[model samples]
Target: MSVAAAWARCDERVVARQTLITFVGLRDPYAHDPHEDGRHKGPILTLLDERSFDRVILLGRPHRADHSERTRQALKELHPKLSVQVIGLELADATHHPEILAKLRVVLARIRRDGPDDEWSVSLISGTPEMHACWVLLAVAGELGAKLLNFRRTVHNGIAGPRFVRELGWGEPLASLRPETLALLSTRRDRWDDVDQQGAAHTPPRHYFSRAILELAVNLSRHLAPLLVKGEPGTQKHLFASLVHQFSNRASGPLLIFNCATVPADLFETVLLGEEGDGGDGKLRQADGGTLVLIKAQELPAPLLARLLKAVDDGHYFRARGRTPVKVNVRLILTTERDFEEEVRLGHLPVEIWRRLRTALITLPPLRERPGDVLRLAKDELERLNRTLPRPKRFSPAALAKLESHRWPSNVSELRRVIEHAVLTAEEPAIQPEDLDFELAVNLANVFTAAVPRLREGFSMMDYLRAMKLELVRGALRKTGGNQSKAARLLGLTPQAVSQILRQTEARE
Candidate 1:
């Protein structure tokens, strides 16, 4: 081939390579702008000498399209073996960080439609401060796999030129952050608040945790470390697990939930491992590149818990009929109602697993502890239920008063059930106190209050008291599921004492 033909072929290769997403700055189009340091050759012009890009994607305000065009023309005339493209980005205001970030995201999303994020490098030194900050944020968030670059004026021995900085990121600074400080910073970020909404993205969203634990959850989400959430039965542990998933780097991945208490013993292995013997797809595979939440994990046998902890420890698992080990990138989150420490003390939970998870533990506060959350949850639940209704219903002052005054012993779950039932069955448009049917708890004091009206004429005080004691003991035994020690604690007696009382009561019956 002739010299010109060979040169054209080489230029075509350079033009075909995709790279470099940047902005045309306010000072980017000028032939020469003087600074105290030296004569400015424009940011994009300086980048040419520092780095080689196949193409330059220039984003700027609509009025500033001329700047990008000027930069493109000058680069094409000056450099023969380069490719460049100009993208006119319309922004309401360059100084508005949120708007600039949003607009850039739209453009990048479209650009990525043609290719992946790794295809281009974003220039943090281009455009306005908002654009620069957005690029840094996107890089830190792992929104793209593309490398970052910046050109800055530098001097060595009084000789000045633009210096290239490669792969601009938060690595060094983030690594230097103390654990506590990192958690504090994570909590202050609004991402948690953004995902805290429960249903339909309503106002007064439900937070998965209280103040301290929320911070911890946010911090834990930044990495792939195992997480354990503890709470009572109705404390919304599943939603808490969702919070962890949404906040993680794997937010785009699947979130699979496995209920430890609901799965039958025979199916547990298959459900967890897909097919234990045949290499069938399991929950682990289904949840790969995302999160797998084990709900009510305390019900899992100690041996099984050991197996899970081992698998999560190294991100590797073995199916019974598998030829080799299966490796998956999954974030494991376990939600349990049992006080894990007590479970460990009783040998119900494996000591090894407990020791490993203790440092990663976070507890959800019960609804009773958060008095203000009761009304909010009730309203939120009501609104969710009313979505399908022709006319939306609001809480009446009297009904709201009753709800606020009552103690929500079962937490958010119980409130949800009550609100749902009321919405479905209530006759009036406005839910009233009478419309709500609280699941009245059976306690000694409450039982006594209810029994007062049932007393017979001339009922002896001593006999009444004796009968009440027996009833309380039996109730405790029933509530404890015939566990004498648990019943004894409820009745303020020793296990042996409880046994004696049970025997006496049986004989009398």
Candidate 2:
């Protein structure tokens, strides 16, 4: 489905009994409020009497079975022949968000199994805020093609009546949800408040260069055929893709991510290009009118890369069994840790896809390159950990110095873990250098093992040792920012000894 066609879908109202599936929320047993009486009574009466629904499914906490039964009996009094299904959740408290979402999933799964053909509608009037949020998420995800039925008492009649909101069906994304609901579900509530009628994009990272890269990505993400993002594994490749998706015109559409490294080649092809008897839509169709993030994109086999290239160029592709090509309006954000030039040279990446990726190529510098951001990100992570831990702790001068000086091979991900561990184990008030749990010795050992292999297999052991020493000296110099004294200190040797070793190594080279 094309993006424009999906957005142009008109609101629908289902009236028939067999086609109608109503999920009504049961009233809280303890609540005794007059103004909120429309919570249960209004939506039920409207659906049963006005809409003529075939079945009204009542959902509530397991401990409140009596409340659900009482509501069912009362509804029966109004329409005795009306089918009522009362379902009690195992949860004692439905107020928590995770619990509500988990229970809702079970309810949704059962509905799909029992009545696959029924058109469903949900009442958000009576459940807890968590329940309402969960229902909204399900609807927004298009996992449930359920219409949201709303009811509020009119001032003129002073009685609740059927109010048609909007229907959530296949192809509809989260942007179709009511603005208020979007605001409530969004974690960046502060940013949400600043947005205009058309929801605004997320703010980019704090770094100046990152912000510039994000600006470029946002522009390219909207209209480009296929954008390529190049970075190391922990260099925020996926994070940048999300930012690009959020800031683009397709922000309203779904952002489906698939890691080429994780998915098997055959299964991935099935997910990307649906087969004739697949019985369901492929991820390409599922991500229509949105963005698709392909992680480790360089790992894609040659044939699959060609297929994706064709899809991007033509804006359509044939499904497994379907003869006719299905038009798709999805933005592609391909991320890879491998070098694009090297891949092209090795024929790992097809020429056509490589050309398509030329539309936009974003390279994210490693965290070590952005040295200024380290302390800021570390402190921010510390603040985040403080909220969950027993006590807040600040980094000591020595600890902070070590953090700044260390060569973070895994980039931001490694730094985050280090900070999390330090926050958890450090004493109150201040985190000392010892609080930071690092395995430098283990890393050195691994480096040595990797640098010298087959030493016992007729290779010269002294030559291997000399080569390792030379590499270590060069690495130390690079890490210490060309400071000989600092490099010597890092290698646990005197500056004069380091100078002599360097001179000897240079002469040998």
Candidate 3:
């Protein structure tokens, strides 16, 4: 049935017996002066007149105690049999969005404890935009199971709204959490940007993709689907798996991690599935009501893979060396070092296992593919490593260039190692190019030499020569650890000229 149709058929008799909880905005368009003593026809009053509520709880700022008390008295006078109470909400300013969100969460928690047997509805029309936003977030996050009330110009009973009752519109769990994540990040957006400005200018888009992956993680967490995370080793598949567990509603449950590649092939099955005569629970049994994370899933033997497929498909499996079936519930999160699809096609991995486990798939791109992330991640890692040092350190301009240039073969793990080494060994406050140690060199100079003239319109021979000279200067600075004196010495020019060239480069940037 359509959502509107479902709400339209709501049992009115049942809702009448419940308490009506709502926020009272500081400004009420329809409210009358208290001393004037005319019947107040505000939205809250309108709602009270139409619906038979058992009691009404009005939440607002403590400073508005008089306004709330008058509202409570008016409510009691209109419906003498009705119970009414006024509660003060701390920090009701719209600019304090996080605190307001926290207050809303607290209110919902109290409602959860006190109104389990009562039908509930929340009004979205009475508060500030920020409060409305918080209310919608709560409803969308499935934290507020209350029916939502809104005002419409046209009345359904010639009285108001087939009142826009809210339906949980966020389709996947990830979709719901995406807004919450954005909200959290939104609160501290300026702080993160300041971190970049104070030290190294970070590539902002790099973190955006991480947020996108978090959206996918939220969806994966809702089911018992066998998740297959495919990425190069050290691309953070394991960390992503942990995030999946952290964001999941099952976060309170256990997370059992076992590396398939580390276990002996003969002991793999027994270790994962557990033997009946074992002293304690095996990996599978231990992970019950929680998550089981398998690292290097590509290394599982064919027999063990077959047994895993059976257990996953049937939701029950017989213990090794025993016939008794053991029922289990585990959200399987698997990380693989190889392309899972290609392995299945080559018959290295069983198709049944692949088909069963492919319910949710997340592929993390290698560091080379996401070059923009290099410096941002490097800066963060460097900052973390410098915390224990005698003094915090930073990277030189040339060293930052080299950090961005080198194609990290081991992804973030390699980056962390390099940063740690630089922090510990460098004598200067700023790490120089010579302080970095990585093998892979991507020669942007050669590429720029061949392409700059062709890529730029109306280019001349002199422009090409200037570009070449610029590349040479950069190469010299990189070699000399960003020391202008050394670069000028290598190029047979004054240090002033090299400094001028570097200034021009910064201006263009």
Candidate 4:
């Protein structure tokens, strides 16, 4: 006997929030099952019409992917506005739950990480029983946070079609899960798990591959203009150079970094441009059709800097003791810590280069300015360290909060050290707040008490107060890599106040 779906109000109603993810089964491509009366509108296409989905993911097994493309094409044709994707995986054994779970977790994690706020649903009508079981587990564990859906095929009032049912009947809470199973779920990859590998943390990417961050700097790459990247010690200038080089059209070519601070200006011509015969083949030729990053470019003498610019503009340079001009197509990316404003005041910087620097500059801010990125970086670092441990380490909420709250004075370099120290020093698998060791920049109370044991007769109160304020401002700026905003925050003052203090100090100087 055939019965009606009972719910007829949704016959034409469409669900607003929709992202449907399901597997491509053997019968998915067929619009109708000829042998079955009610399933005339076959499983997938029929379910799609009955359900609501703006985006669709058709997960296909390696062996059964013959109809994946056809299904995708058909779905696109039917629903022109729908976003469809067919992802082929290597899960050959349809009955193996573990393999299916692992592969599905990776795919789902990627989707979730990319758009954590997007509303999505999982269909259990298409895949094998084992696959359905995995989906249930995922949804129950809160890994999904997805709506559970199933399609019911039946004949109702002489109409044979599919009906989409949403309620799956809630399962027991996570507390009922075994301690070990709960632990496994806790370790599941979250959105922050994929923190950019080559960020301000200075993790180097493989020379052969390009790892571009979603940054303003990425937009400047692939251009032929001279680029200037300026920041304090740990503000990711080196990493930015790598990012630009890898993403550039000359990525296939070599990337050569020459530090001006390490080598003297006398050797800039020979070392960078190279010398002939006994001298050596310079980086200019070596980095032909690639990128050459000059670290601490301000250290180059005025005369050497002029010659370098001429070579860059003319696309050729003379090697020391060589008659022939060495022609090369290399992108110039210069990094520096020198305060260009101060150089401008001193009149040590050339006008054209200074203008170029101002126009094509990439300023990397200190870590304290990026509050949202701090925990993501810290959690990523923690996970990386856990791979080497006997048992995986987890951080308490307090510990994580502590890491997030710290104004990272020394930037990413300091973050790396702190995380490393905590991971190794932590005795238990769970790291507590006390386990974190921060190298604070100032100790005002202690310093004040120690420095001024007693006030001398000639010590003026106003002068003493001014001196204290100056030292505090100077210390905050130093700790925060000359970042006025971070220095102001540290001093419990506004940026304008900090600027006024700095101006007063400069006047005194």
Task: Pick the TM-score winner.
Answer: 3
Separate clash counts for every candidate: 1, 3, 1, 0
**Alpha carbon lDDT of residue 21, candidate 3?**
79
lDDT of all predictions, in order shown? 0.67, 0.64, 0.66, 0.68
The reply for model 2, stretches above 4 Å from the true place, is 1-209, 440-509
Can you give the TM-score per candidate against the true fold? 0.49, 0.49, 0.51, 0.48
Local distance difference test, candidate 1:
0.67
Instruction: Provide the clash count, candidate 3.
Output: 1
- Give the Å shift of residue 446 in candidate 2: 11
Q: Please say which candidate is ahead in lDDT: 1 or 3.
A: 1
Superposed model 4: Cα runs more than 4 Å off: 1-213, 440-509
Q: List, residue by residue over 1-509, the lDDT tens digit for candidate 3.
A: 99877787785535545787777764432455453566446667767766678878788778777767767877888789988877789884664668888988888778667767777777665655556557656666677767656542321111221232222232233344555553332222211112221111221222424546756765776666778899875587776776666556665577777788678888887788888875355788888877788888888887787777667668899887788889987778889878877888898877777777776788888888888778878886775455445689999999999988888777776776567656655779999998885531224213432543455567587656666678878976776678786567545467888888778767867
Could you tell me how far off, in angstroms, the CA of residue 77 lies in candidate 1 after the best superposition?
41
Candidate 3 pairs with clashing backbones? 155-160
Q: Give the top-scoring candidate (lDDT).
A: 4
Q: lDDT by residue for model 1 over 1-509, one digit each (tens)?
A: 99999999998766545588888876675435466666566667766767777677777677877787878888888777776767778777876667776887788888887655336777765565556656655655567556767543332222332354545444444544444434333322322112223221211223434545555556888877678899876787887777666656676577777778778776766777665555477787788888889888877777767766677777888765565687877888899888989988887776788888887888888888888767877876776556546777778899999888877777776676566556654568999887676752323435633635466789798767667777777876665567776566545566888788778778878
The C-alpha RMSD in Å for every predicted model, in order, reads 23.5, 21.4, 22.3, 21.5
